[model samples]
Target: MNFPLILFILLVITGSIWLLDIIFWKKKREPNENEPWWIEYPKSFFPIILIVFSLRSFVIEPFKIPSGSMIPTLLVGDFILVNKYVYGIRLPVINKKIYDMDKPKRGDVLVFRFPEDSSIDYIKRIVGLPGDVITYHDKQLIINGEVIRMEYEGDYKYIESGLGYIYSDRYSEYLNDESHSIIINQDIRGVQFSNVRQFQFRDNCKYRRTGFTCEVPAGNYFTLGDNRDSSSDSRYWGFVPEENIVGKAFMIWWNFGDLGRIGLSIK
Candidate 1:
């Protein structure tokens, strides 16, 4: 559902009703007469709705994690808060940027509208920036001819919704200045070229049996899920256009299954 659009609609309806009554309907009523329930309800709600709409549109917004793609960094039930203005202040619903701000950096966790389907939102870590050449082979990431550092952590185990328990190798990946953990299942190979669609800038990427290499197009970013082998990310689709960006996810405010995760800052 397009939540911001719905909230904007409600805000307009309530504000219009409240304004119309003040200009035309107020004096028509008898002096000292009580307001009708219909008028009273909308008038009372307009200010509150306006405040909520403003905050959600230009300041911050909340989103829930629906998949295990982010794994150790974010869980299935994690409710995260995204900083809306950190990247730029875009108009709500239309999402057209009216201000300029910092561009997304490598290793930053970003939430963006899926390039293939704008209505669907996806979250992934930025692995490649504009003009950077990214290569992934043998479960290692290389950017601009430099191999990103990776150190083996240990064996990691987790439970899948219906697959019971699964084990994988965990490693700490140092991408530029950001250090984060990732998991890889050696039994599964990387995405196959045949399974990928002819997305925009498809020619810029070359896929092989082991891995793939791509040069990020201008104003676009390459991303990947923390759960390496389990994620369906840029390797399978395409780059994330700058306009499709929503915001940088910064914190986990709630997690029904794990209260300990509340208030934890996102890496």
Candidate 2:
């Protein structure tokens, strides 16, 4: 469902000009009077274009956090802004890179096309870099032969607009050397990690619960979810090709019922 911003802008421009021609310009009523300089123009296209440019280039773009796969960190209905330029500027839609930027780092929240289905966009945290072995066993993340450290922080209250509440474990884990808290539903464990026969880019992945060792393939990355046990990530689907990346998600700009959702970083 991702559309190129260029198409959106073109649509807006065409519609605006055509509408103005019908309402005010057609009759030529004002002529020089116009509707008072600024008022006479659409005045709408500017904001739209700004949003498209910022979202398509140097800043963040809005996205609806879809599934509970990212439960504790992101929730359904949470509309977040993904950092576009952090990983470079690729024109929207076709996703052709015209500008080069930094690559994704560990502990970063990312948005990318599902390796299994490029048409579907999925978000997860980067767990393994190219050539790093990643293993997850007994719910612990093992990367490059080292287990990621996690500290228990009791429980967190789950909040969804109208849904009352539920308590979940609050644990802080360090990845890419960055520390962050995540919520987990213990009742959801016991599911085994499955491996892919072969992936589009990389060939195969090893499976374990204490974590597995996966040398991230060239131009491919290993990703997981902050809500560990819940994500359908590289652990299940396979590695993410560099070309599949949409962008890096950094902020939550707005939430319908709660403005407090704004200004939080994704990691």
| Alpha-carbon local distance difference test for all models | 0.92, 0.73
List the lowest-lDDT window of 10 residues for candidate 1: 187-196
**lDDT tens per residue, model 2, 1-267:** 445656566656756775776787658765555554444344545556656655555566678987767877787778888777778888666677788889888778889988788788899988888878777666777777798899999987765455777567889999767788877767656234443445654445554454455678888888877766556777667788888888888788777867777787777
For candidate 1, write residues 35-59 as lDDT tens digits: 9998999999999999999999999
Q: What is the overall TM-score of model 1 with all chains considered together?
A: 0.97
Model 2 segments beyond 4 Å from truth? 5-58, 157-167, 190-198, 201-203, 208-211
TM-score of 2: 0.76
lDDT of 2: 0.73
Best candidate, lDDT: 1
